[model samples]
Target chain A: MASKVVGVREFDSLIPLLRDRGYDVIGPTVDEGTIVLDHVATSADLPIGWTDHHDKGTYSLDKRADEAYFGYAVGPRTFKRWLYPPRQTILTIEHAETGLVFKPEPTADERYAFVGVRACEIAAMEIQDRVFAHDAFADPHYVERRARSLIVGVNCAVAGETCFCDSMGTGPECTAGYDLVITEVVSGERHEFIVESGTDEGETILTELDGRPTTPADRKEVRTIIEDTAASMTRTMPKDETYSLLTENLEHPIWDSIAERCLNCTNCTLVCPTCFCSTMEDMTDLDGRAVRKRRWDSCFNREFTFLHGHAVRFTTKSRYRQWMTHKLAYWYDQFGTSGCVGCGRCITWCPAKIDITEEIAHLAEQTREEVAT
Target chain B: MTTTVTRRPTVAVWKFASCDGCQLTILDCEDEFLSIVGAIDIAYFPEATRAERGGPYDLSIVEGSITTVHDAERIHDIRAKSKALITIGACATAGGIQALKNWADVDEFAKIVYAHPEYIRSLSTSTPISDHVTVDFELRGCPISKHQLIDVIDAFVHGRKPNTPTHTVCVECKLRGTTCVMVAHDTPCMGPITQAGCGALCPAFNRGCYGCFGPSESPNIEALREAWHEIGVDDPHLVQALRTFNAYAPEFKEASETYA
Candidate 1:
């Protein structure tokens, strides 16, 4: 709960310290021309001095003047992959002499300390937590992984072009759902991190760092940085009205127009932080050893709605509508929260540059016109 | 649940008008080939063995397309003899790149390439084996995936369905953690419309997928064309990308024709 000001070097030392404490440090690194979440050894492995320019269907990494480690917005990947993997074996079956023996996948014991996690991503994780861990039939693997993982979140210094976290009431600042949170403040000749501990484990790590108490000036700077980020965000969705707007407009012509631009590529859902739909695959080898794998499936796929040997949603219009409506509207009925975290990965990574915020605005505009009539 | 052991299932491989790549994929299963031989009888495979056995075969794996009158008739004969006929590769599944002749005059092409056009007794339009006879299953790709080929064989030997996915290449890219080329670098990719089988190869290598694997289950080509246009990929390039490998696949052929 207490905030402390640590030198940039002290902040970098946390990686090795976490590693020493039996945590695999997962952090943001430049890989294949984009910032990606990967196995990070030290702060040097982090995308130091790198800032990414993100817009509708465009992303390019650029070097910043300051050596800001967490300068960029969220990249193609999020903390979701670490928590809920793209593909994982759920069960394995073997043919025994007497009968067939069934075995569930062993619960993973490896602890992960995810570094440079974004605020919106934390919100996405919380949404997934409710899906996998809080349900009546909780996923033991997800529950175990979530329990063991330590989140080291970073407050955004710069808002991405497609980001609308401020409007979603999820970000620009690391508000909750982090063990430890950092605000990188670079002013004049001094470079420091205003770090705060949210849990006892975080407190223990913070105390070990031996950082000085945050002065009023330091706290003021962190606030200014967060405020500036919020101000920088230009793209926004009308979050409060999203539920009713999407639910009410089932037959709206806007979906047809959106479908024309949408490729139904599954890029948006795959890159999205909170899209948790999956399909099961049963694989049997020649030896009669069978394994059942749970792979990430997208609602954009025609087969996602298959029933009675026929696809329920056969057209692009139906699939896209289901994806967007389920994310913005029907998710409230099912999960009591909006599926979208406003991270803007879907907008940035869409080959068609289909902006969710723009689509919502269009729906809102059409609704206003109907009301006026 | 117990079935008595009888004669091993007999298999025959047939080729008509393709580059022997798909048959090579059968050979490419070097590790599985020995076990495949142990499980089933390779009754007739001209590419692999000298000895030939007559069918009344259990399963016949066909490659290539019906580009010639003789090959077209031969496919019907093979279908009648075989209990189950599985077509493999883009050639057998969707008529391959040679089906581009469907858009052009085959006689004109023959006259230009051949010394004597009269000597070439070819059909007007190259068509898939399914056009001539009943096909049990179709394994799709430019050259079919080795793992999938093995799966098809194993599934046929045992009475089960193969686990070949009909999802887009975009799904494969995400599963493998490859960043989308079109999104990251403005590279126009056909992965959104193309089927998953090549493991999203081109995008993983930082290049756009040229779509060697054909259209996905629901190929939204018009939308992809628009998306490609936004990224400065003109109509000509989009059309060319669609008219490759699996060019004559109904979904791709229709989209390419619209563009043309």
Candidate 2:
């Protein structure tokens, strides 16, 4: 793939190009004091010159010192919400003269051109793709949505405090799984983006846009910015022994201590780009018309583990253990890769400020202590 | 017109001593209300309909708290008449905000509020429907969520168990993709201890969970108190936090009493 240096003004051209190709351009915009993904028709809709300050349970928006469109980290909303909706009507059943007739809800086949996708998020989407698409029985809705969407990746120039993509080896710079990747580069007074295409569709779109041929100086600046982002990350997880440590210490006392602080709110799982638990519901109108829908469900819910008439994971400790272990350990067995992308959305959005990395580290320390004694 | 038809399942919405918010939630489901009415017979709902039909009802949704002796006896009567009795809202499930009186003297409260104490026929403590009668299920919330209420009715009509989550509000906050107000702002949120429902409304507005849905299944109230303490929350505030809409709930009550 060849890189092209496009002025910030020319970058706006991609939106119209995507829309011209019948794509709904989804990008980050400021809403309710936070950055949220919404439909963007032009460059004005993007959160330009705005960054976010994120910490444990804290997120606030601020004016960026530089006018960078992709300055902020991933926000609360994920692309998964669009691909796999919170509540979707799977089947609608109506009582006919013959009997009850079941009809699957029509799938929306609109092409979504997702802009400002961070590298860690792209990893998250791939994890979800495995869960929804690669399985024995692929979810038809997820399959259709995944197929129709075009990913426009944004390489991070600055890392948030909670970001630990370096440790997870996902990225501050996206290597693959994107149609086109954009790196926002700001010089003394001028701002531009170095665009690279990963696919033919992306290459065609880039050609349509007015961009200057990339110079060696532009490529050097892009490398420096990506490296700086990688160096700026403060949080990291122990990659080698996280799975083993967590699985081995399921009955550890630390879980009980963690549970005490954990509200069992399922915020971490819900915000997680990979968590894909859902519950089926049969909704009926008074007119004998029924709709069977699937809504997002969390393992933190007591009823999530309900068996027959009894709840299997009755305690908060058990539920928390199940969630963390499933994400770090069991997910590997199921998906052939770690479930987490180290996006740090879970830590940032946790009301309790429970850090997954800290927990894993605690479990590792406990394991060492047990062996020593 | 000549043929006999099978009767629809009769559902009666009853109120005891509440703000009538929960019952209003049913009416608030305007889009679904017509659909709900088509599936079941609304035998007695004072909020929506004036018609009073005698029960032996298939299902009964009881709201409000037993603040008066008459309400206590009335709930038992409702239980006897209904095949399945489901309590809606915090008052019916955990005595509600009125249960704050459980900590104070009712006699003093009555005298303070009423001109003549002799006219009052209220009980000393506001209690839930389960305290007076055998409740088949308790749909927990300050004012029960309309969707969950629909789920209860739908489940009963289909002869299956309702799929109401017994998880905390944290799950909903996560699903809605709301930033954690407590974590970001050091706000004391009850979301971790509060039951899931209301779709994490407060947090969505950049506020903390007020525990409107009551205590979740197996809440670690002591642990939550300790965490709050670490965050510099005092004993009085902790007690006050626990005594909200679902304060009288067993899990919250025990935690509040320790601080009280």
Candidate 3:
């Protein structure tokens, strides 16, 4: 039998059914002047008619369609919030009249059936899975949260202005590591979901949905949708190998240009889903019962690379250089993967308005000129 | 939580001249942390406890730089107390981000990061722990990797050196099958100079490495500088690159001074 298709009318019914199967449906909607993920119930909660034009640290919103879920790509936040919470209570210490005992807090109690997860985010999930869920020193909380979750991946219809996913070879389309892949098609009367299944869990869910079986025409339509989305991408990667060229130019003078405006606030690290830099602090109550807490940190801070009361990357230029290099170069060594997934959160949100794409292009132009010499 | 072993090893975490991020990476061990703490009796973690457990510590993890006269004296005291001393992060091993003070006027550096320069007491240059005393092992990163930290600790407990690679991050990029950002995009990066540890993060993001891991084994820095110059890296930024966490490490220091 061919796979099924659920109409716009039938879509609302699917949410409760998904919840009945223990899926915690999360998706995008306009919040606080930006698109954000929240508890989406009705299909109306989706950011249907809204789309955004994002450039280096600049974004402008517009209303394109009457429907709520048209613009699909990466957002500032990710499932990192679920797997690795911002402020997790690692352990709790209680002092009894008798003595003192340390107690570990329990891991996440809720499992989410993530809805509308972008392809890049899915890849990000896989990368994070490797880091936090390994046998070497397994993170039980991450394992538990990631294990029971169901992901519904989406193909991108709109790419970020700063996005370079095509360069990393990771996304703009849903490929793997997700239960169900959905492509949103909106041409004439078609605002439908063209689904593909990557796992048995997705197949099982597909079996439960009451839509008609997918046909050859459906496959063709899905293919056309994804291809069109990929073609619409405005950003292009450079023509040559990225790592070697970058690794060969450690002393390049381009950093000073970007550093001129770079604030070194470390917001780039804060919004980055993969940036795992952090620091610890101690709090003592009035009674002097001390408790410890760890917080998210950024390499952009002068202290991040400080030693012996000295600051490495003291100049904003060096700090800028360090952050970019590690994001593009050194992360490969640590994880056997590129630390950045071309999410573009850093580019759009940076207070400095530095565009990685433009900076790289300038370098490429310079290299081209040098080659002629 | 594990009562199976009675005499757990005593673990102590120390800091010198840093913002305390490397030690925080240890705390970020989050879930495995309880078990690690269970495995070790945390002796003298000023950031975590007021217990003030004494030393002859089974293992001591040091973070930050040795920039002050007191810190020079303090490292020796720490060495006497620690059975194994492992320096964590770029700050501790490479003199950290603060090592920028090593190059410029000390008075200027003091004015840069702090509100009142007179309020602070520090040395003219930030130096690594290895400069002052012997370090059993050193882990790299502006903020050290958690898995690497565990590996170093595990190796110490098992009586061996941690198997961290000494090659450049470029090797890691090749292994990961990443498209070179510099050659393809002509983007200047530091993957060649920096050691492998951050998993080639920036390159994956379609950016370049800024030498977060410190200088690699036998860094061909001059060759890299020529490539950078050919690639449009300017002189001022070149000076900035060699002045990072591991800036004062003789090789990078020499390279930066040569360009300057």
Interface root-mean-square deviation (Å) of every model: 2.8, 4.1, 15.9
Model 2 over residues A75-154: C-alpha lDDT tens digits?
87888888888888899987666777789988888789999999998999999989999967889899998898999999
Off by over 4 Å in 2: B1-5, B27-29, B32-34, B45-51, B226-233
Measured with C-alpha atoms, the lDDT of residue A193 in candidate 1 is 88
On residues A1-373, what C-alpha lDDT tens digit does candidate 1 reach at each position? Answer: 8779899878878999999999998999999899999999999999999999998889999999989889899889877787899888999988776677799999888799999888998999999988999968899888999999999999999899999999998998889989999999876787888899999999899988868999888888888999999999999988889988988999999988987888888999999999998999887665456689999999998887888889999988999999999999888888889898899999999988889999999889989999999
- After TM-score superposition, the amount by which residue B60's alpha carbon in candidate 1 deviates from its true location, in angstroms, is 1.0
RMSD of 3: 13.1
- The C-alpha lDDT values of all candidates are 0.89, 0.85, 0.71
Q: B140-206 in candidate 2: lDDT tens per residue?
A: 8888899898888877776666768777787777566666666555778888888887999998887
- Lowest lDDT sum, 10 consecutive residues, model 1 chain B, at B1-10
lDDT of residue B1 for candidate 3 = 22
Q: Candidate 3, which CAPRI tier?
A: incorrect
Q: Pick the candidate with the highest TM-score.
A: 1
Q: In model 3, which regions exceed 4 Å deviation?
A: A96-99, A287-290, A307-309, B1-260
Better of 1 and 3 by TM-score: 1
Worst 10 contiguous positions by lDDT, candidate 1 chain A: A281-290
Top candidate (DockQ): 1
Please give the lDDT score at residue A304 for candidate 1. 79
lDDT of 1 at A113: 97
Ranked by TM-score, the better of candidates 1 and 2 is: 1
